[model samples]
Target: MADNNLWHETLHDHFGQYFAVDNVLYHEKTDHQDLIIFENAAFGRVMALDGVVQTTERDEFIYHEMMTHVPLMAHGQAKHVLIIGGGDGAMLREVSRHRTIETITMVEIDAGVVSFCRQYLPNHNAGAYDDPRFTLVIDDGVNFVNQTTQTFDVIISDCNRPYWSRREPVHLGLLRRLQTLPESRRHFCGPKRGLLSAAG
Candidate 1:
């Protein structure tokens, strides 16, 4: 609980949903964005990237599981999984739980987010970084999608919320490029490709 009447709130004006903080645990401005880990009496540990709430320890499982499982399940089977911009590794952790998954490649643009999540918001990652099936690539996700010869059964986007920035547009363009890949092994179906975003 807050010592005083003071409250640190993350207000999502569009959705009219706000998360309140009781205590601040960690706050840092990385090269990319401002990252904050705070304590909430109701939500446990809460993380915010660039002023938008990413996840709360109390409900992180729900978000991560849905982000990972729903897509993998819908795809029928996922052997090679590609994650883009999930520096917290929550999505990777959930993806690695499936033994059927042969390999997991996680591409996070910001190394700082990865290191910070490992150090302070460790609960989100849960040491999934050490999993044998997991591979970490610290580079621009757009570049990876555009240049990599590797293909995947599933792709996940777990980026920070858009704050009137170019990240989301660039990512969307990257997805478009992914959609245009060669028909044979690009997606499950040949000639037509399906695109799904975890934006909502």
Candidate 2:
């Protein structure tokens, strides 16, 4: 419940954010988490995962751009990228902007989230799902990273908050693994909220 029948996202003891809900766009539960997408008067559309606000439609570019570009730019000659957990496809959309990058493989834990966003929050991903250079892998990011024999020039993790996902160790372990890539210049991009999660 929210003021004027709007939708609310509260992060218990820390903070609360609200959106004017034009309508409940989509709501469903996938194997890994509950997903919600709704039209907001201010943000256009919003997506939340397991009650935690993940990303809003309006400011997504800031996150996506920095997440995709900074690392790619820093690594200058990156040809391959491995994105972990960007189920919404926004990061994929940003990454596809670079024509020099030949391939992008995105690993997400929930296919339902990808399916849900593609249908309802259609513009959020901006058709990145169907890009020829993109590949989607539905699996746990940690497991994917641990098991994959292939290496990438850049690795981006577009996951939600660690506290919300109960996977802090997995995220940290992935970072530790990134440090050990022996033969390649590996660059990493992950959530900014990870700093807060790490502190806790």
Candidate 3:
């Protein structure tokens, strides 16, 4: 019994140390949400939704600037933009920097993600969620893209490849819908562009 107790104590201590170094423990009591907090040295206490790290104090600018500037500079004069799967609103905050952008639409499937980001990751989004020019849609990104008759000057795919790949049917359906759009040019970011083209 003493040996078993010692082993259990060792295991507990190991797990506690791992959690202390790697993640911030947020007590999640909500019925429909996964809340996490990261004890990041630079970002301090960082809160995230659904186990996804939205941003850290150390590297938010790098991601925001890269995601925004690369495409905005490439297009040169984008007046409207569409973002698929960036529920964190970081991309929206970046897109708002360009004065040329008149409208920005963000489509994310999880409303919970958006709500959580608004509460936790305020620095990343910069309160762009409430902007009048920004339209937030809580729906399947593909369905949102398919039904829209309006074509954007630029479309930013801000989703993770692995997650989108897991939902192949939805991703493929969206690609097919995008092909039907009148726009001659389509630009895709992230790792799943090949799958997108295949679906198209």
Candidate 4:
């Protein structure tokens, strides 16, 4: 009877504290990545990879909207759009907002990133993945740009900095290929691509 009573007391003490806190950091690990999802907290959830914040529970829209809309509005009428390296699909979401866009082609190197964003970062990408107007081509942006004859009214490069030794080569190749498309008005954005002077 004494042991039973002690067990009951311990259970009450332990389980009782669980409900007191409304939120906690739940650590989750997978074969491909490790993530910490903020549960019942202000930020809801975020995917952290290699100690870097990949996406957050809130304010993703603000970033996406600002990145895409500013240039799009400046162009006035963007019927066709091309996105390079934005596997997150948030840019596509903002791009689709413009009614003038007839087609949007997104070139993503990693399909896994897109899949992960669709599943885990739904708040950021939402249902933009399912939109018919958004066409995803799982290919290198440099190669895709070089081979394609299709021109875009606006081209948004969402790639990260060129860390690879061949990055400049790829960038030059893409730029050279883009120059051949006389109809398409090119607009280069993002960190690495933005560094090049207009004369270069």
Candidate 5:
């Protein structure tokens, strides 16, 4: 809730940031999390999940580009890509830019996030959801990482830190699973592969 049109984000007990809301576009308690989309004079539009700012229209490209492009570019010959938990679709939009990628599998736990973002954040996603190469799976990323037998030349873990009580961090779980995979199937994750890891 915004008091006097100011939305305060308490990043920590001692530090935070606030945005002046120009308009409240949408608000809902989704099946999986709390979601809000509001307009800010400076940010243009702001989307927050579970009371934390996720993406803003003004500067989303910086994050989406870096996360999607850096890894794919580094991989050089990446054809298949897996994205774990980028329901907002900004990451999808960026990844779709690579013409060489034949398939993009995105696993998102919350379908509501995809529904809302697709409707409200059109600029961010830019119809990437409708791309023929995209395949969206409404499932937990941890389960996908553990159970899937498919191989990807590049895998992008775009999940937020876990908010559920006592659940393992999403990326950590993926890392653990990756560690047990045979070296032949371990694509581009470790330091030896010249790719940055979330583990460190």
Candidate 6:
């Protein structure tokens, strides 16, 4: 909540962080999540979903580049890439930088996240959304993986943590589905912290 000019992120009961808001750009409850975008002197623009910080303008390159480049570089001949739940467009931006990749498909559950982030967080996407190689699908990532007939050389999962209501981690479930792909080289990259495990 915005108290005075500061926005407090109570991600945990006992521990939280505060970012001084230079301006409150957008705040609303979308169909799938609560979204907020605000400007900060340090972070430039900050986006929070369900009261948890998701991305920032200032250092987005660090996370985006690492998650994108590391796996792509490792899978040297990757021509097709799939991304799950990167609604902010940062992942697309990084992935599109590769001239070798012929197709880039991103599946995001929330359309609203894409709408506002495109407007308020343009720097994150940087016109990657318009690239001819890109395709955006509004659907659940898990279901997309389970049903997709298409194949990808590299798959990146840039999603938020699993819902607290669910008993199992969503990444693990997605990983299981990824394994069913034909016996060939498949590279998978997920969130680096506690949320995901990399598989190749």
TM-score per candidate? 0.82, 0.83, 0.67, 0.63, 0.89, 0.86
Q: Rank the candidates by TM-score, best first.
A: 5, 6, 2, 1, 3, 4
Clashes of each: 0, 0, 0, 0, 0, 0
Q: Which residue pairs in candidate 5 collide?
A: none
Give the alpha carbon lDDT tens digit for every residue of 1-200 in model 3.
Answer: 01221111122324411222244444363454565545555455454444434456567777768777787787676777888877777788888888778988888877766776677667768978877789988877777776666667667777633342245655556667656655443433221231221110
User: With candidate 3 superimposed using the best TM-score fit, by how many Å does residue 140's alpha carbon deviate from the native?
Assistant: 1.1
Residue 168 lDDT in candidate 5: 72
Highest-scoring model, TM-score: 5
Q: Write the per-residue lDDT of candidate 4 for residues 90-167, one digit (tens) a residue.
A: 788888888778888998876766776676667666677777788999888888876776766677776543232344
Whole-structure CA lDDT of model 4 = 0.59
Q: In terms of TM-score, which candidate is stronger, 1 or 5?
A: 5
lDDT minimum window of 10 residues, candidate 2: 191-200
Every candidate's CA RMSD: 3.7, 5.1, 8.0, 12.1, 3.1, 4.7
Cα RMSD (Å) between model 2 and the true structure? 5.1
Candidate 5 Cα RMSD after full superposition onto the native fold (Å): 3.1
Please provide, for model 5 over 43-158, each residue's C-alpha lDDT reduced to its tens digit, 9 standing for 90 to 100: 99999888778889999998889898988898787788888888999999999999999999999999999999999999988999999999999999879877777877777888
Q: lDDT for model 6, on a 0 to 1 scale?
A: 0.82
- Ranked by lDDT from best down, the candidates are 5, 6, 1, 2, 3, 4
- Give the per-residue lDDT digits (tens) of candidate 2, residues 1-200: 43475767665669767777787778787888878887787887888887777788888887778878887887777777888888888888888889998888999888898888888777767888888989898888878876776657777877776354455655577877656755443423322211101111
State how far residue 4 of model 4 sits from its true place (Å). Answer: 36
Question: lDDT tens digits, residues 68-130, model 1?
Answer: 888888876668888888888789889988989899899988898899889877878888999
Candidate 3: residue 168 Cα off by (Å): 5.0
